[model samples]
Target: MDCRRLGEAGPVVSRVAFGNSLTAGNQLADDSAVACVRAALEAGITTFDTADVYSDGRAEEVLGAALSTVPRDRVVICTKVGRGAGGGAGGLAPERIRSCLDASLKRLGTDYLDLYQAHLYDDATPLEETMRGFAEAVAAGKVRAVGVSEWAADELAEGARLAREMGVPLVSNQPQYNMLWRVIEREVIPACEPLGIGQVVWSPLAGGVLSGKYRPGAALPEGSRAVAAKGGDNSLRRWKFLQDDTLERVQRLRPLAAEAGLTLPQLALAWTLHHPTVTSAVIGASSPAQIAGNLKALDVALEPDLLVAVDEVLADSVVRDPDLTLSRMLRRPRQA
Candidate 1:
């Protein structure tokens, strides 16, 4: 796999990061999850991204155990804070930031994180407070670099300003971007590129809609994410990409993928990475074979004409509203 600098100041990481939410959570069996992580390592994916809120911290536990066999320095471990873990207060409060980083480190079996990100923009806390907390983490040697996820352009600008003043490198942003999801392109990319903040995009496949497994008129395929959602796995339903129109548009891209000698999923991933500001596209796999297939995207580059054809096929269906960048604060009863 090809490697790239995570941002202006972060470590060099695999262009395709192995996301742990799917396999490490309850969605997959424990052995399968561990195997999938090993499979990613075998495929040369050196970057792993996870969040503390995922499966109420089980995701990080699984990832930690999976990485025990590999030397820590060989991989970049990127985890997130700011979403409440195990019933604690949520948000980017200074105390919460420091406490969360400590907990994440213990769960990940590491002394320090390559990158620790704010899972979402915490509007309730002062941006200065959050940046200061991150700076403190860096000072304490608990976190190497800092980043954020799903932050608006204005919020990012403010955070970047604070990080600069604190002498901390606000290196990366984790946003949802894919062939069908272009919301980040409307403003976030513009704001981030100038600040030297690279994007490590999530949902690069639109939650498997771009994989061509879900057809426009066909029934939900057995064992697919849509099926999982129907069985009450609501996480995969966030994208809303399985709609008839979107599926039809995705189906039309088959020929484009064929022309490029790639699968539809690879085409989508390659397109996301084609942008100059995207440092990595996070891919979650339920099995080792999936990782092998996704790794192929590192070699598939979409020509200019193919990129235009993608836009033409997805015309009017692409999600580009800048306002979608704001994440809603979720309130849940504290865990026992």
Candidate 2:
């Protein structure tokens, strides 16, 4: 229920931004989708995160239709571009950006977006061409601020510089950051910290791996993302969390959450937000009450001792070890 500033007074956005990346309604009925959005809004979640590619924009339609119920000014509307209608070549082509925004506006049923982000970096596209499109959006007052998702620190820095050179505003960046996934801690945080760019993190729960569901010698839950996402190259990486005692560390946190009077999910969310660089934690949900469970993390600060305990539990754990997945160990830093 608590809110935070989006960049410099853009809007007071919810600490826990409701997300529809998965709620894009591949199967949900239109009426059920409405209930989901209504439930999120009623639960005091004012900020919504969606993408153009999600369900081929059906997600945006549902998200927009839901937000329409509330006074527009009361909600923080965030949607992304660059990822286009089709999966191929979803970059920030200048004309493509314009068309993308115009279509999103129509789908969202809004004149402007509170926070419009680039879905991902287009290495093939010229940086200026892309950022300039965002600049155009800002100039036209169709978007309040421009942000990027899943971009590396260098990419963000370049984008910020381009925004400045072009006299545009780049306010936020979304990256996959969590205690377990601290890849950004190495360079991304340092890059954005002094530049006035904020971080909105995805997978703060490691795709629900940190939700405290798995146990030692346990089967992946029947209907959870862990079991259902076993197709070729699914990002869920079925049972991947058990690669090196991840679930063990997560289970350890249960008693730690008990001590803190919080649920494991709450503890997971709080730990991500505990970092100063994070501006908001995006919580994607299937039903409405998922937002409520996530919102319990509001203001639930993790104490240092518990954090130390977590670190100690993970001290012996190994991920990205060169010995495992050794083929491309030369490509990136080895997990120690």
Winner by lDDT: 1
Expressed as tens digits, the lDDT of each residue in 202-291 for candidate 1 is 989888888999888888887776664322235444556767898899999999999899999889888888988899999988779998
List candidate 1 segments past 4 Å from native: 84-90, 229-237, 328-336
lDDT per residue, candidate 2, 1-336, as tens digits? 877776653556777787767545653556766787787788888888888888889889988888786899888899998754333453687888999999999999999999899887775578889988888998999999888876776777898899889877788878766667676676677888777888888877777777877665777776555553333115545326655377787788788888999888888899988987788888766566666777788868778998898777766552422122111222246489
> Model 1, clash count?
0
Clashing pairs in model 1, backbone N/Cα/C closer than 3 A: none
Off by more than 4 A, model 2: 27-29, 84-90, 227-233, 242-244, 316-336
How well does each candidate superpose onto the true structure, as a TM-score?
0.93, 0.87
Any idea how many clashes model 2 has? 0
What lDDT does each candidate get? 0.85, 0.75
lDDT: worst 10-residue window of model 2: 322-331
What is the lDDT, from 0 to 100, of the residue 305 in candidate 2? 98
